[model samples]
Target: MPLNTRILLDNRPRGEASVSNFRIETVETPPLAEGQVLVRHHYLSLDPYMRGRMNDAKSYAEPQPLGEVMIGGTVGEVVESRHPRYAPGDQVVGMGGWQQYSVVDASQPGALRKVDTTHVPLSHYLGAVGMPGVTAWYGLVKIIDPKPGQTVTVSAASGAVGSAVGALAKARGCRVVGIAGGPDKCAYVKDELGFDDCIDYRQHRDYPSLAKALKQACPHGIDGHFENVGGMVLDAVMLRTNPFARMAVCGMIAGYDGQPLPMANPALILINRLRVEGFIVSEHMEVWPEALAELAELVGSGRFRPRETVAHGIESAPEAFLGLLKGRNFGKQLVKLV
Candidate 1:
């Protein structure tokens, strides 16, 4: 029998989860069923979407039950395999929650991709070549469907998903502007990602002024908006969209953690004749292969660059998750457990 150390949800968080909301404990590991595999966690992905899971409120995914191990996607090495398809020493990406070790049925979604790290780092699977990469590609290329010379703006521009969206839009010959919260991220979006312009939302004093700034940068008005933070930023962008513009609402990190929800600016939506759609990357799983292939080629050829913020050790998982919610992480945030 093995002892697995895992993080459990002690109490549901109201706003801004603290380490106290989680309790870490060592417990007896369960026996692997005939189709299961025992995995030792290598890296865990800490993303903004996990914050939505922490609350008991309605969401696209089920809430984390009290006393259950906190859920997350992990890349791991198979230590023992009872399943015929997987074998010992196979490196896999799967949902293993926050733990040092886990037993999975091998039937779950995200069951690893056989990877060769010599071509690209295995960590790329968690960033530019993984879920985030797929979301940006599908949303921008297929959903928004930007035409050449069209103006596209994406918020949260320096984060993993946002940066990828901006880069792909640029590759498609669109005029791209990115909105990030701080000067550092603003500079990175413009100087690194080749965005035509980057707005520092934190520097703006008011919503109207921020709207004016975005309008100034996008003299032609926006043909598309890739929304990540959905409170005032969404409202502001809604006012700036030209007729027939498309909005892909990927996330609402601004109101995550029980922050007071803002009323939607319906007037702008109605008057501008904008088409807005909300999406979950999981829903588009069938389209992943096409997205991944394009992204991999871009990344392998140095046409795409993904920034990662890694925190060492599983013990720092809570802090890493909190940092993601607070916009402290510059890109895809990960916890290295091995």
Candidate 2:
């Protein structure tokens, strides 16, 4: 059995999350039972949603229990398989957690799906063609359905989900704008990701300044929004929305550390006739096939390129994840387990 190195939640965050919250350990991979497969993970995904799960407070999902392997998405090859459907050497993606190896019960629905690395890189199964891509699809297509010539904007625009949302919306003929942390991120969002305009949120400390920038960038007014960061970003977006605008509230990274994030202006929703909806992509299993197909086409055809920021090993996950929370990571944050 492979010796698995894993990170566990050592303690919940008091205010801001730090590397101290995690603990690392090594253990032997348990014997795979019938219908199980052993996966040696090549990469593990670090996402903002995981931060919310670290808390013991009531949330859409269960809290991360102390002393358990930290939850995360992973893509790897099946080194050993006892299941009829899965085979050794089959590349698969699953919630393999923050570990170098995982034992998956392959019989469970959506537990492990084989992926081809011929066109799309195996790591892409954890990014552009996987959960983040699906998330961007659901938010834009299902919630903030924008029409051609309409202006749409996304926060954390250079990120995994936001970049996908921008690409998907641009393909639909909508003018896309993005909000990012710094000059370099904003540049990537505009130059590389092809957003019409990218605002550097750090340049504007308050909502008023950010709102003015949005007005200049989105002259047509924001018809739809995909919100990843709340607080001032959301406030600015709300102030610039056109009538009957739509918003897909995917995450509120600004308040992930149990901080109270109140809307600055609640009246804007009714006044602007906005439809703001918050969603968890996992709940809408029905849309995965359709979403993944389109996203796969976008990625496989080389139309959309999702960037990644990788940390070298399991021990690097905590610091990498902390940087992600602080908006220090440039793109999709990943831990290279192999």
Q: Which candidate has the top score in TM-score?
A: 2
Q: For model 2, give the 10-residue run with minimal summed lDDT.
A: 257-266
Residue 153, candidate 2: how far off, in angstroms?
0.5
Clashes of each: 0, 0
How far off is model 2, as Cα RMSD?
0.8
- What TM-score against the true fold does each predicted structure earn? 0.95, 0.99
lDDT tens digits by residue: candidate 1, 1-338: 57888898899886678888998888898888998899988888888888888889888999989999898888878888898889988888777899989898887656655565667677888888888889898789777999999999999999989989988898899999999989989988988888999999998766677888999999999999998998778777777889989999899888887787574677877788888888998988899999988888888888777788999987788888888889999878999888
**Residue-wise C-alpha lDDT for candidate 2, range 104-153, written one tens digit per residue:** 99999999998988889999888899999999999999999889999999
For candidate 2, the lDDT comes to 0.94
Question: Candidate 2, clashing residue pairs?
Answer: none
Model 1: ten consecutive residues of lowest lDDT: 109-118
Q: Give model 2's TM-score versus the native structure.
A: 0.99
| Candidate 2 residue runs with Cα over 4 Å from true position | none
